[model samples]
Target: MWLKNLNTIFVVGYPIFVSIIWITGGLFSSFYRHRQSRKLLTADEEPFVSILIPAHNESDTLVAAVKSLAGLQYQHYEVVLIDDCSTDNTWELMETLAKQWAGQLAIHNLHLPINQGKASALNQGAKIAKGDYLVVIDADSLLQPDAVTQLMTTLLENPNYGAVTGKPIVRNRSTLLGRLQLLEYVAVIDLIKKAQAYLTGSITTVSGVIVAFRREALNEVGGWNPAVMTEDIDITWRMYRNKWQAAYEPRAVCWILVPERLRGLLKQRQRWSRGGLEVLITNRRGLYLNPWGQRGLLLESIVSNCWAILTAISLVAYAFQLFFLHNLSLDGNLLILMFTLNAIQFTIGFIASQEIAQLTLPELLLVPVYILYYWLINLVSCIAAISSYFVDPQRRGTWRSPDRGL
Candidate 1:
């Protein structure tokens, strides 16, 4: 009876919980958009911004990415390119670019002796950054023409906003995997962020692809935590804990390359999952204390972590029963219900993609494929993350160059 009740929670409760979050996200997103349309964003003066591009074995795409930012409409900004001990010719290329675009672009280059991970490199850059705001950009990210202006303007508008993250549009969508990821980013990531921002006035993770931070807030939180794998996420929570606020600027879009192969995608997802778990584990005290009304955010984290664990256990038990007991019968209603819930989610995602991502009607035809691909990949990655946590909990958060789909 206990086993049956537990299975019911996994099969039914999970989907119901997901539906609530998605629906809430949709409603909140709509409200946010409505409210935002009424406001006029006027910039009295442009704040000095420092763009921090951290690269590690990113030679193939670094130059193009940097070039894209050179055309940013924002006038008062400098680019600081940090090569985190790249084994390849990344630093050499950066040095060349710095010399060439010296006057045109106030570009500076920094090379590290050893690869101490992205967080450390960002910290070193922050120490020397002369701008009032520090904008972190991934080496493979192409910022939109007005990305800098949009980000800085948003930050300037609200002094409470400690950091602002831009919308990351997947650029390389030629392959099937890339296309699926594009949909995921738009339908899933984009919508959820909007909703989270509206409901809690906070988001789970800041898009590390391109995000701007005020120097004051950065100093208050002591910058990025090198101990965590996802420095973006770590810093976001830290900002909240320190009485600082973060916001999402959907209009400030940054084009980024997503993993095109299954292996690359899985590795990326696993790392994200592991990082999320690490944050939740390390910040358990914050959840109980509920300082500054962070209980909602903390509760969301706890529920998500529990859901992952429950899902893993449920899957293993079901598989065991199926192999041992030939009498095992699949729950037809539960399967149908799951599919129905997923269809509802796909519809919400489709609507969001159309409005925010500007995805055409023809592109909507790939919804089913995306649903299957992402669902399966996420499940596998969840299991892998949980396994990694148990097996190597004490492992240091280190840098490993992901397959850039080059």
Candidate 2:
């Protein structure tokens, strides 16, 4: 009886509880941000921003990315294009662009002899960056005209904020998979960040696709850790440990491509999952010592990972019970409650993100599938990440161009 009750709580109650928290927190954050967006914010001073693009064989996307930066409304910025030892013509393209934009915009082209990784590339760029604020964007990213301005406004307003991450909007939605990912980005990723920032006052991780960092904060944290798989996640935690706040600015939007195919999506999720696990493992001591500080960000990470493991086990046990034991006791009401809560959360998310995401009516049809999609992906990736972490813990954090959707 005790075991059954525990199972029930894990299977039903836990998800409901988490859903409620996210819903309330997300709604509160959304409304607050909506109100804040109405106010006019003027920066007292224009700080020089170094836009860093770390590329490894990203020749196809680099030109478009640089072109996007050239249209930014913000002034006092330079582009630092770091070619991480690309075998292709990425270097040549960078040189050509550098010469073309020489008079218009300050373009610095740095090339690495050997492929160290994204983190290494960023560190190298930072050393040569002339800006007080550093904005890091992926090679495939297309920044909005005012993205840097918005990020800078938020960072400058909050003197304690060390970093601010922008929202990533999926640009390629031609395929069904891409559309589904677009929904995920709006409903799950963006919603969760809003809730996290509202509830905890600090986000778990900054979106690496588009994020701004203060030079002083980066210096204090000792820059990006080259050993970690996800430098973004690691740097956020490091800032937290060093008493620096991190923020999520939804207005600072960046258009990025998502993996359209299942294989590509799996590979991407696996890398993300593994990087998360790596961060947790590396910062176990700090988390242990300061479990409740920073609103228990590290503690929440540990809980979320454990929940994923238990969820996988629960599914297997349910299968075994139904097939072998022939005594599957499913709670219909509980399932309904879970579904309803998830629907409510997604609805709130959609409404909050509608302005920025420009969500369509057709995309709304995939809400049910979207919910189930994330659950399956999360479970599979978590299990794979755990396995990979134990098997190849010493794997170098390198870079590879991911599947840019059609």
Candidate 3:
């Protein structure tokens, strides 16, 4: 009876409880944002921003990214493109763009002799960057004209903020996988960030693809950690440990490509999951000693990992009951309640994100599929990440160009 009760609470009760928190917090955040006026900076108030693009074998997508940067509405900014010893023509492409936009924009190119990871390249870029504020974007990302302006304004307005992360809108929706990711980004990823910020005054992690960091904060936190699987998650927690706040700015938008294939998507998710797990392991001391508000974020991460493990175990138990004992104890009502909660969560997220995301009716119809995909992918990735961590605990943070959707 005790075992059954434990299973029921973890499998059904915990998810419902967390979902409600996310939905309530997300709704409140949406309304709050709607009421607030847009904050814009005057010419004198604008700060110089150094935009860093770290590329490793990103020749295929680098040009378009640089071109998009050229059109940024923010005036006092320079572009620093770092090629991390790519085997492809990424270096040559960077040089060409530097010359092409030489007179028009303050474009600078840096090339590494050996292949270092993204974090190392970023550290190098920061050493030579002239701006007081640094914005990092992936080589495959296309920044909206007002993205830098929005990120900088939010960071500047928040006197205690160490870093600010923007929303990443999926631009590749041509395939079923891509469309699923699009909904996941809007309904799950973006909503969770807003909810986390609303509830705890700090976020779990920043979207490294398009985040702006204050130079002082970066210096205090020792910049990015190349040893971790995900530098973004590690840095966010480090800043929090050192008494710096991290914020989420939904208005700052960046169009990005997602993997359109299952293999690529799984790889990406596994890397993300591994990075998160690594941070949790490395920062476990903070759970007990950290006096800041970030303890909530750490507790949430622990709950999530426990939930994944329990969910996997429950699935296995259910299969055994069905096959060997010819007994299935699944509760129909509990399943219905879970589904209803998920539907409500997605509805709230869609409403909050529709304006910026331009969500369509057809995409709305994919909620059911998206829900199943979300659970399954997260389960598999979480399990795989755990296995990988135990197998190779000292894995270096190296990356390859991800599958850009066709």
Which number leads on lDDT?
3
- Estimate the overall C-alpha local distance difference test score of candidate 1: 0.81
Better of 2 and 3 by TM-score: 3
- Candidate number with the higher lDDT (1 or 3): 3
Per-residue lDDT of candidate 1, residues 117-164 (tens digit)? 999999999888899899999999998888888888788888989999
* Candidate 2 TM-score to native: 0.95
The candidate, 1 or 3, that scores higher on TM-score is 3
Lowest-lDDT window of 10 residues in candidate 1?
36-45
* Residues 1-406, model 2: lDDT tens digits: 8887687777677778878878888889978987874432344467889999999988889889999998988878999999999989999999999998888889999999989899999999999999989999999999998899889989988889999999999989899889888888887788888888998887889999999999999999999999988899989988888889999999899999899999999888988898888888777887656436454767766877887888888889889999999978878888899888988877887887787778877777888888788778888988888888999999878877669874
What lDDT tens digits, residue by residue, belong to model 3 across residues 262-329? 99989888999999999888889988877555788888888888888889998998899999999988
Q: What lDDT does each candidate get?
A: 0.81, 0.87, 0.88
* Candidate 2 lowest-lDDT run of ten: 36-45
Pairing residues by index, what is the TM-score of model 1?
A: 0.92
Model 1 clashing residue pairs (backbone): none
